[model samples]
Every structure is written in structure tokens, then in C-alpha cells.
Target: MDQKTNTVASILFMVTGMATVGVIDNFITYIAVEVSLWQFHFLRSMIAVPAIVGFGLLAGWTLRPLRLWPVLGRNMFLSGAMFVYFGCLGFFPISAVAAGLFTAPVLVMFIDAVWSRRRIGPIRLATACLGFLGTLLVLKPDVGGLGWANLIPVSAGLMYAFGNVATRKWCEGESAVALLWSYMFLMLIFGALGVIYLHVFPGDPSSYLTRGWVWPSASVWMWIAIQAVFSLIGIGFIMKAYLIGEVTYVSIFEYSMLIFASATAWMLFGDRLGALGFVGIGVIIVTGIVIAVRSNAADN
Candidate 1:
């Protein structure tokens, strides 16, 4: 009973962490409207670098892990995943982007199954199909309506799943702070590449995607600071949750981020999905909950 309680609590913590990240990302979208994409990444990395180091020291964690190359490679995948995710925000609704990204859990399941050469159970396969259907409803991609850019967030979700698998399979025993710092270092490197690209070949100034680096205004600094703080708290809880709970069960709760993002998008940006979209979101959550419950039962 106590184990069950702890599992439930950990799942809640994971959901809360994802919700916090979703809300923070909405604020990031607002900030991105006025700042360059890479600039935001660069500045957030700057703040997170010191903040993560301080966190490691305060928590008395070993900042150095025994395995270096594997950890770096895993984080590079994560950084690329997030880079595409944030870049999509420049061109798409946060809710839509989030809905697409939440497919990571399904991808995780599929990847694990393939890697193990195990047959996917009937119920799990059905739920995965249903989830994909829900994503289509959210997208509502008609002929020539949704462009190739829509694929970006979907690809990000796949990369994120791969990164998560690498974390669990190869990077165990490493401190969460160490994992986080590696991720931030890659973010800084990616940001520098973005800076160089923009400077050498600029494009439309009106679009955030192609805009060159600019001096951070006071407002940008405030938003970047907010992102750094909330991200630290949220990612810490999330990493702990992943460490403590069954990955399949815990990952289902990550869909809650879409719920939070949808509300935040509506409240802050006057963005709301249509009736079909809401229904699709409902389908995804209901199916995810069912899968999570079944997964937990099997574990027991």
C-alpha cells in the first residue's frame, strides 16, 4: 500500500512538473515574440549554468559522472529536441505544438518494444492507434492546409522519446544536476550556431525564426530569469519522478502538460482550439489514463 501511495505521489509530482514547464513555455513564446530564438536559448543557458551548479553543490551531488560521451550524446539529442520544439513555437500555436509533442510517450513505448523485440499487446497497440488519431484531430490537416513545418514538432517528440530511453538505459547513477548541466551546455553550443547562422545570412526581420541577435532588453532579461528559475524547479521534480516511478506509467501523466498549455494559451494568448480539437484532446487524456492504470497494475 505504501509503495502504491508513493507511486501515485510520484506521478502527481511528474504531472505538476510537466504542467509547470508547459506554463513556463507559454511565457517563453511571449518572450520569443520580442527576442530571437537562439538568443533566448543562449541567455537561458547562461542563467541555468550557474543555477544548476549551485543546485548540485547545495544538494551535495557529484557533478561529474563516470561516463562522459554517452551522457553528452543523450543530452545533445535532448537539446536538439527542445530546439525544434521551441522553434515550432515561432510558427505554430503552443497548444498544437504541445499536443504533437505529447506523443513522446507512445514513441517511447514503441521504441522499447522494438529494441526488446517483444510483441506489443493488443490493448497497448489499440491505445497507441487511438492516440495517433487524436493527434490528427488536433492537427486537422487537410490537403495543402498543414505545411511541412507541422512535422517538426512530431519529430521533436520522437527525439525526446529516444533521449528519455537513453537516460534510463545508459545514464543511470548519474546525478540529475549533471544531466541537466550537460543539456544546458549543448543548448549554449546550439545557440552559438544559431547566432553565427543569423549573422552571416539574415532573413526577414519580422519573423523570429530568421532574426539576428539583438541586445537583451530589460523585459527579455526578466522573462529569461523567470524561465531559468521555473525550469530548474520543474526539471528537478521531473527527473526525480522518472527515477522513482515506472517510466511507462509516469510518462502517461506528461499529457497533462497539454491541458495546462491549452489553458495558458487561451488565457494568455487568446488561443483556443476548436470543438473537435478539444474532443481529440479529451480522447488522448482518457486513453492515456487507461494505459497508465493498466501499466501500474501489471507492475504490481
Candidate 2:
């Protein structure tokens, strides 16, 4: 593929991957029972392992054994982010939880500047402020209620931003497949621990595994399988996009996942947003994309 075609293809791939994440997340939510992150993850790896290995064979990436220390470090933070973010989903709406986690870009821009020992300019600060304002709209934190649920996704976002910084600095030498392999293994470890913790520590743990493990019908399997396939391809696309596009611009499209998720909710689940929520999400998305475009323009 020509460079331009390659760039567009990469962008599309990232968009598809991110968008698929929302569907998988929301669809799982619709399953009428909260899935244990541990069991879900264990199953995810079981399915993803074969698919990823096959993709590697076709792509001709060498199967390299991961270096233990680095993979452990990277996967620790990555799994932490996933665990916190997904846990937030169990308490909040998928799109709302996603918006809260979207704070990663704001965190990234500042974290990057701080790590590089550069001062953030006023304009960037203002844009971040606007974005936060929009996030609050979506979160609508009711201090008196279980509204603190917003914090879960926000914490997840912070960890994710830190992980992104580490990615640029530490994982530069690693192959994309290698990164995925190591992350998968780490995630498996994380899942096992989570399951053990839930089952052993919680007094009413049987209620969990009993919640919804009923035989999944053909439709659930079909959707889940499609989600998995798209996700794997999407991961490759995102890695390629990060290689070609500036990191910040590439990250901006991450917000599109919110838009896609909300739209899917409306169509598939008849989710409706109040006036303020809709307006707020619109502002949040536009601001994010604008920030990305501005950053790209500045780079060019």
C-alpha cells in the first residue's frame, strides 16, 4: 500500500477497533448479569490466544519469548487500567464510564509535558478545562448518592495515561505482536487473581459465578466472536496508526468510541440521553477532536 493509503487504512482500523470495544462492552452489559472481570478475561484470552497466534502466522511476525521484567511492568499498569475501567462499567452506564476514562488524553498532554520538563501553555490548559467541564456534564456526580462511581473511570484514565507515556518511552523497541503476547499473559495472571479474590474473600461469592453462566445462545456467541475478531484487527490497526500518526492526534480519535457507543446504545438498547447530557457529550467530543487537530496542525 502507498503511504497515504496505509495511513488511512491505519486510521480506519483504529476507529473500528475502538468502536468495537463499546459494542462488546455494552452488549456484555445487556447480558442481565455482571460478568466477573476474571472469568470474562480468562475466556477472552482463551479465544484471543488462538486468533492472535494465527494472525501472527499470517503476518509473519517471529514468535519471540517475552522478556519477563519489562512485560510484567507494562502489563501491570495496563491490566490495572483495564480492571478499573471495566469495574466502573459495572456501576455506571457504558458511555458515561467511557467518557470518564476519556480523560486520559487530557492527562496525557499534561503528563507528557511534565515528563519532558516543559511547561503547559495557557491555551492547552484552557482546552483541558473545557473538556473537564464536559466530562462533569456526563458524570453528573451526585455527591450524596453512589455518584462517586465516576471516580473509578477517572482513576482508570489516569493509569491509562501513565501507561501510554510508558509505551512511547519503554516499548519503542518491542514488536506489536510481542507486546500483545506479553500483555495477554499478564492479563491472564490478573484475571486469576481477581477470581480467587472474589471467590475466597467475598462471603457471597457463589452469587457471582451463578449470575449468568447459563448456556450462551448462538446469538451471544456470534456477537461475542465478531467482537473478538474485530478487536484483534483493531489492535493491529491502532499500533500501525500510532507508528504513522503523531501520538496525540491518534489518541484524539479515541473519543469517537464514545460517540459510537452512545449511538449503538440508542439503536440497540433504546438508550436516551437528557438534553444536558447530549450537549455535554457533543462538546466533549468536539473539544477532543479539535485538540487533536490543533496538535497535528502545530506539528505539521
Candidate 3:
């Protein structure tokens, strides 16, 4: 019974974290073009690093793992996934990129099945397919605009799938706060290196792809600060969720992110979806319900 309760709570935490992540994306979208991606990561990590470290220290938690390389490897997969996914935003619509990234859940399911050599029951398989279909409908990827570049986000999904599974399989004993700090620290290092590269070889600031290292305005700093706070709270919950729940089951809940992002976009940008989009939203909700119900059954 306790395990069941924890599973339910973890699912809630994961869903809430994903929703908060949606908000973070919205905040970043406002100033994304103004600041280079590396600068954004570096500046945000400046705030996140201290905050997370302080919290871990205050709580008297272990801030480092027994084995560093595996943890670093896991974080690298996720960080690389995020960077690649964001880079693809320049080539594709945010929705399409997100749809590709959402494929992570399916990959998670597949990887788990293959690694364990266990058969995925029919219900899980059906729901995964339904969820992907719903995501495709919601994203409405542009067939004409699609090209070889579309592979980037799919690769990100694969990386993310590996990272999520690694969190559960390899780093189960580690503190979520510690793992969080490591991730931020890695991003900080990479961000710093990227800024140095921009300094050495500058490019057109106006060009979206080649641009790097712009001096952020006061408002941009404020936005990055807000995003950092969100990352702390949001990522903490997600880390806890993966630590507590089954990876294959937990991953399916991430589809709710699209729903959350759509709602945020509607309120913040006054962006409304058409009828097909609404239908897609309904399908996603159904997908969530199916997964939640099945997860409960499995838990019992």
C-alpha cells in the first residue's frame, strides 16, 4: 500500500514538474533570440548552482555519488538531448520539436523491454501508440518543411530515453539534489566553453543559427533568473519522480507537457488552437488516463 501511494504521489510530482517546465519554456521563449543559448545556460546555472548546493548542504544530504562517471554520463545524455532539441527549434516549429522529443517515452518503454527481455503487455503498448498519435495530431508537423534536420529532435529523444532509464537503474541511491547540482555544473562548464568560443570567433548577431554571446539586457537577466528558479523546483520534482517510480510508467506522464504548454501559450501569448488541436488535446488526456489506470493496476 505504501508503494502504491508513493507511485501515485510520484506521478503527481512528475506531472507537476512537467507543467512547471512548460512555464520555463515560455519564459525562455521571450528572450531566446536576444541571448545566445550558451549564455542563457551559463547565466541560469550561475543562479541554479548556488541555490541547489545550498539546499543540499542545508538538508545535510550527500552531494556527491560514490561513482562520479556514471552520474556524469547520465547527465551528459540529458543535457545533450536538451541542447540538441533546442537547436532544432531554429529549424523546426516548437511544436514539432516537442513532438519529436515526446518520442522519449516510447523509447523508454522499448529500451526497458529490451534490456529486461520482458514482454510489454498489450495495454501499455496500445497506450504508447495512442499517446504518440495524439502528440502527432497536436504538433501537426509540417510535411513540406520537414527534412533531414528532423532527425535532430529524434536523436534527442533517444538520448533522453537513455538518461531517464539510467537515473532509475544506475543512480537510484543518489540524492536528487546532488544529481541536480551535477547537471547544472555540467551545463555551466559547457556554457562557459561556448561563450569562450564565441569570443574567439564571433559571427553575425542577427543570424539565428550562427549567432553567439550577446550582452543581455536587464530584462533578459531577470527572465533567466526566473527560469533558473523554475528549474530548481521543477527539476527537483522530476528527479524525485524518476527516483521513486518505474521509468517506463513514469515516462508516459510527460505527454502532459504538451497540454500544459498549449495552455500556457494560450494565456501568455493569446495563441488559440483550432478544432483539430482541441481534439488532439482530448486524445492526450485519454492517453494519460489510460496510463494512470494501467499503472495503478500494475502497482496493485
Please write out the lDDT profile of model 1 over residues 1-300, one tens digit for every residue.
Answer: 465675787687888898889788887666777778888888888899888888789988888866999888788778888888888888776756765677798888788678667777877778777876775565444413455766778889988888877777678777777787777878988888888899999866777878888877798789899998898778767776665665655766676677677777778787766787688788878877777667645432
Q: How many angstroms is residue 39 displaced in model 3 relative to the true structure, after the best TM-score fit?
A: 1.0
The CA lDDT of each predicted structure is 0.76, 0.64, 0.82
TM-score of every model versus the real structure:
0.87, 0.79, 0.93
Q: Which candidate has the top score in lDDT?
A: 3
TM-score of 2: 0.79
Q: Rank order by lDDT, top first? A: 3, 1, 2
Best-matching candidate per TM-score: 3
Worst lDDT run of 10 residues, candidate 2, spans 205-214
Residues 1-300, candidate 3: write the lDDT tens digits: 486776788789899999998766765565676877778888899999998889888989889876798899989998998778766765555677787799999999999888778888888898888888888777765434766777778899999999999998889878888889999899899888888888789877875445687778899888889988998888888888898898888888888888888778778787666677788888888987878777767532
RMSD of 3: 2.1
Error of 3 at 238 (Å): 1.1
Residue 160 displacement (Å), model 3 = 0.9
- Can you tell me which runs of candidate 3 are displaced by over 4 Å? 142-144, 296-300
Candidate 2: lDDT of 29?
A: 58
Off by over 4 Å in 1: 1-10, 132-144, 200-204, 296-300
